[model samples]
Target: MLTFKVLAALLDYPNAETVAAIPEMRAILKAEGVDAPVLLLERLERGDLLDCQAEWVDLFDRTRAGSLHLFEHVHGDSRDRGQAMVDLAGLYGRHGLTVQASELPDYLPAFLEFLSLLPEAEARNLLGEAVHVVEALAERVGRRNAEYGLLLAIVAGLAEGPAKPVRLATGDMDEDIDAAWAEAEVRFGAGAALSGC
Candidate 1:
């Protein structure tokens, strides 16, 4: 009973050559025990794989659409990139995802993993703020949430890359848990505050 929607707006048919070259991707799906026809139809109808693939695509679309409207409000200038990141982070937060200080090292990588799956613009918009918030909170938490942090780090790393040259570090803090809580608060507030864009 995994009910989901495949919006026609995102549909795209794969060419034969492209499909032929994706045996590895297909094999992975098979290894995961997905029904081939269901997977194909789901991907075909949604323009991407299930799991994070479809979610990222949808988030990208929403971010892009929101950016367009935001530009109008600012006389055609781009909105604050940080705000876009906040918006994206808010989306993930709503799904019960957030980075913790103790788990910074591991979580950072996960965050980058998820970013890699996204379009450059979408990844930049969403993950850039997420890293900042995560790092900031990590400094306060003293220790990160090992499980959640690892999950986020893996997902983020998959989307983007390692946070090395980027130096996305969470600094020292008096209260690490508070920092993480604040990050979640920001995300929740943004989710509630954002209007039609």
Candidate 2:
């Protein structure tokens, strides 16, 4: 639905395009009866774009807890996460949605976009499968930014059912936040040392 698309855009990093679209986004959300993000849209519209961008980076990019990648919370760098991403990407492809090379299929915004293309019941059912991740993200993000948390809460509400309780711990002071948030390198076909075997 358009509501999900609007919510997805709001969840993404704030940019000039998104900032400029605030009035239209607000209208879509209101028209869809999704009012949780109205205040967020108002704040974004009134705030400096640079400052809004900085806030988005601080919340989503700087910490594992606030990651926009849903699998980061679900699989946490495990090998399973890679396979899960592949499966999710395949799902998107089957549904005629092509994810960008730079964007993971499981990214929350992308996932929301996918939902926007599906029938309401099916969309809610799919979202329900990831409701725990959405709820966890809401808790983590809300703890730091209530507006974002509300957005995610609205997302979870659109799911088919309530999410189960999931406790996600925050990082410790001794942890290396940068390393924790670093992107893993993608390697081509064969192992570099395969000649030695």
Candidate 3:
């Protein structure tokens, strides 16, 4: 549904394009009866473009705690994450979605976009697999009082069952956490290492 796309857009890096889409996103959220994402949309609408972009970078780009990559929370920087990336890419392919080389399949915005193309029940069912990631991220972002948390809560709310509990590593410095969960490039196809698979 467009609601998923709107949520994805809100989660992505803000730019002039994102700002231009606010009215339509607001309308889509209202039409879908999803009220929470509208708060994020409204915040985006009110904030200065550069300030919004800077906040997004500070929260998502600079901190592992607010990362948009799903596997960052699930598998950290382990080799298994590479295989998971390949598998998720294959999943998208099966559904007729071609992920651009610039974006990882597990990136939250890309995943949400993938969901936007599916039947509502199928989308929610598929989202169930990542509910824990969404919930954990929501909790972390909410602790900072970020409006982005509302968007994640909306996603978590759409899942069919309770989220599995997640345990985040504690007592680590920010740089240490970033170093530990740092992202690695994912390659596809034969001789591509299957990402160490």
- TM-scores of the models, in the given order? 0.25, 0.84, 0.84
lDDT of 3 by residue, 53-87 (tens): 88888788878988889987888777988999999
Candidate 2: clashing pairs of residues: none
Which portions of model 3 miss their true places by more than 4 Å?
A: 166-197
Model 1 agreement with the true structure over 52-140: per-residue lDDT tens digits: 34443332223222111221212222355446545545655765676554432122334444444545567655554444344333232
Model 3's lDDT to the true fold?
0.82
Q: Provide the lDDT at 65 for model 1.
A: 20
Off by over 4 Å in 2: 165-197
Q: Mark the 10 consecutive residues where model 2 has the least summed lDDT.
A: 166-175
* Cα deviation of 71, candidate 2, in Å: 0.7
Model 1 ranges off by over 4 Å: 1-144, 164-170, 174-197
Angstrom error of the Cα, residue 60, model 2: value is 0.2
